[model samples]
Target chain A: MSEALSHRDRCAIAGIGATEFSKDSGRSELTLAAQACRAALQDAGLTVADVDGVVSCDYDLVSYGAIADALGIADLTYWGQTGPGGSGPCAMVGQAVAAILSGQATTVLVYRALNGRSGRRYGLGAPDPDARVGGRGAYEEFFAPYGLVTPGQFFALLAQRHMSTYGTRYEALAEIALACREAANRNPAAQMHERALTLEQCLAARPISLPLRLFDFCLETDGACAVVVTSAERAADCAQPPVLVRAVAQSTGPRVQPGVMYPMLMRPDITVTPSQTVARTLFSRAGLGPSEVDVAQIYDCFTITVLLQLEDYGFCAKGEGGAFTESGALRPGGALPINTAGGNLSEGYVHGMNHVLEGVRQIRGTSTSQVTGAEVSLVTSAPPPGTSALLLVRG
Target chain B: MSGMFNDVAVLPLMPVEDDHDTGGFFAAARRGELALRFCSECGQLLHLPRQVCFACGGARSEWRAVPGRGRVHAWTTVTHQVHPAFPTPYTVVLVDLEEIDARLVGSLPGEAELEVGQPVRVRFDRAPDGTTVPNWEVEA
Candidate 1:
């Protein structure tokens, strides 16, 4: 827990890029990866020859070498990937920072490209036993046979507990859904940009699982989003304003094993997620606190994911998320405007990569729903088997 | 099971026969009993059976049968069907097996009014795949 030798502000994100978000990209994952990588390099005033490192999520269909090859990057010095999906975006940036500070590579490309809606959708439920490889490990035997398949179903049990424990209401969830949709309405890049959601519409949405409705789930979208990372010194010479990486941390609570994908059954208390640990480590390393965060891009894979993280990340006291969100804290003019790019909820589900892009945008003063004078932005990965978070400050 | 909902037959994905970790649990279920793996060295009970003891790093574990009754910790009624095999509208419950210090998830195939902390007992049902798996019935 030595915080004195922190890597805060050692690296910066100098470029950001993405392709059109839609239900079907109509392109191969590799093409999407190459398109986003080229755009990111061009954004940073760099080129394929400038990039020596590559990083992505393990669930990404395209391999790191394939991306570098597609973009004409030769002689890569470093490449890596983080796993289990959802909890990857911020960690990917963290990987880039570690690589840069350690001299494994000079310039790194962090990207995520997938046609999630049209290909291998996560919410479609469990894969056939024969179809699954090594990661799950006796997982389906315990839950799938009983009809507990999708991530949404597991979160429903958690949300139900939180509701029973804290009196959290569905209307509070509606508040979160409405806020993101309102933000999306202002951002043309958002899939839900043209569509505005009302409290009434959110509240009345049909149930996918109890205590969680259709709107509660994030959009299953097809898209690719990426960012370019380099040494803070090098970033200053790039094209766009550098968003300094203040701190990043990833953690998993004790006893969160065995049920790798969804460990709800083993957890003593399902209300708290791994974000609690990540928050403590992230802020401690950054030499800052939650009160200093001007805006956030908390992952919204599900509305409950947002609610639990609100408490776990210390945005509010435990069990106070419902009332806190109801107070409009997550809205545009509220205390902390989150998911300003509409997030995974409305913008697109490029996993949480879009959240990272939005965080960088807020720092660069380029966000469509930009928070006025926002200097410090927080971006968190999904709250699950494990979680990660990052702090970006205006450089 | 008189009031159970059976209109939609569910043929859920069954366990792989050679899965070393979960094979014993399924074998016990076929015999109309609920069993879980316990660390032979440290006595830590584990569900979704594990190869080693997480509590003490014990390398050996063994299967033990326990009472099938427990209280519902939390639950959800899934209205949307994510798989073709499982039709819409099924209630899944997480039961806290306080007696064995373990937890398990099973579906309520019949109509039952369920709530947190309500008593539930496990019942064995044969899947369409010809494998016996544990489901739940609310105890009146």
Candidate 2:
């Protein structure tokens, strides 16, 4: 394997900011985007006028030019949009890093804002006939006739298979939900903060899909999150310490088709996925391992995803993620503190952008729930079916 | 007035083309067998077949008839139908093909009992015009 790129060769996240996590923002998505961008610029000791590039997901309600104009950005030299849902944020970071490395732009802003909680709830399973531009339409046409429409229903099938094959009980899965809730208790910004939830409470929660309780699912919050990325050289001159991008990679699984069965099941390798391939590449490139990571902010759209990521990232062996997560291993002061800002399970879901912001906070030494001497952090996504790892050090 | 009445009558049965690719797909579905185009150079199977190969960017491709036999990779039993056209309670399965290393999502027969690796064969239901959609059924 090739040596990982040095911190100086790539870009660093200079600032991270977010709107208040709530059920209702009462503002438009465009307004949320602007607020988050302005706050991030303030955190970076710069103004919106300093930003020369922008990257976001294609599904975002606000356009890049609109956000730039709203924020009073003079002109954008580089703009990128990613396809997959949650994967957009990490992919944007990858694009920003490439833009900075290639000299296309000096400073790039990455943001995700949505009215998912108050406006459009993703949990309500339905196929929009108007969404006929991509593979989603084809999948819907083929599968909707048979009944698989909701994401939870689709994932529940996978969970059922795991339960049968690995003897993973529903209670064991509930443990992950409980642990995340306990972590959220320490974070004031978390939606479920200070609300101690027991396994019984999690089990008692209403079922969206069989084997998936309301608590097992992530909250849909009306919120926006932004991060500022610049060249390591510029980061050195900035006010906040840079959370350098150590190594980044993305991969697709063997299924070779979107919403396909081979990749989803019968692959005989659900425990370790293509996301792990990216994780391994990242660790090898950076010359670091799971042990070296001080904090991790994994995509927690569902608890099963987190368990699978743990194994795929080599945090534990295959089928051992259940045992690995048991006994508060993910809690603060544990062996490896993960999702310190309350994961999507407890924190607001901004398509895992908040996870990235929390990562920057951990490195900046300003996290509300700070981990002492945190140096390296890993942020991931569950969409576009990929993972991107960054190694940050105190500079 | 006659033309408008005829247009309203034809609207329900009108063949709506979602995209250019769907046109090609419905063409293949007219035949009893199911086919997916695979790049001859890289041997990569294309789903929702496009004009070119996404993997190797190769242009030359050939259509091959597959047995349409596969194992259920993942599935969900949906109890709610958000769309007016679809009825409540359906089964959707991701089928992993044995012929080429590829997977496709399709509706499975609601009455059939399915396991993760259950064997299935392809069945198509004729829609409006000559188009037939590919569905799955348990192999006898």
Interface RMSD for every prediction, one decimal? Answer: 2.8, 5.5
Worst 10 residues of 1 chain B by lDDT: B1-10
Worst 10 residues of 2 chain B by lDDT: B1-10
Q: Can you give the lDDT of residue B39 in candidate 1?
A: 90
Docking tier of model 2: it is incorrect
In the predicted model 2, the residue pairs found to clash are A146-B91, A261-B94
lDDT agreement with native, every candidate: 0.85, 0.71
**TM-score of every prediction relative to native:** 0.95, 0.84
In the order shown, the candidates' DockQ scores are 0.51, 0.18
Residue A260 error for model 2, in Å? 11
Best by TM-score: 1
Give the C-alpha lDDT of model 1. Answer: 0.85
What tens-digit string does per-residue lDDT give for candidate 1 at A1-395? 44346688999999999998999889888998889888888989998888999999888999987887888887899999986668898999989999998889999999999999888888987567444222347366677767777899988888998998899999988888888898899999999989878778877888898989989999999889899999999999999988999999988877666555665556888898899999999998998999999999999998889999999989899999999999999988898899999989999999999999999999999999989999999999987777889999988
The complex in candidate 2 yields a DockQ of 0.18
What are the per-model C-alpha RMSD values against the true structure? 2.8, 5.8
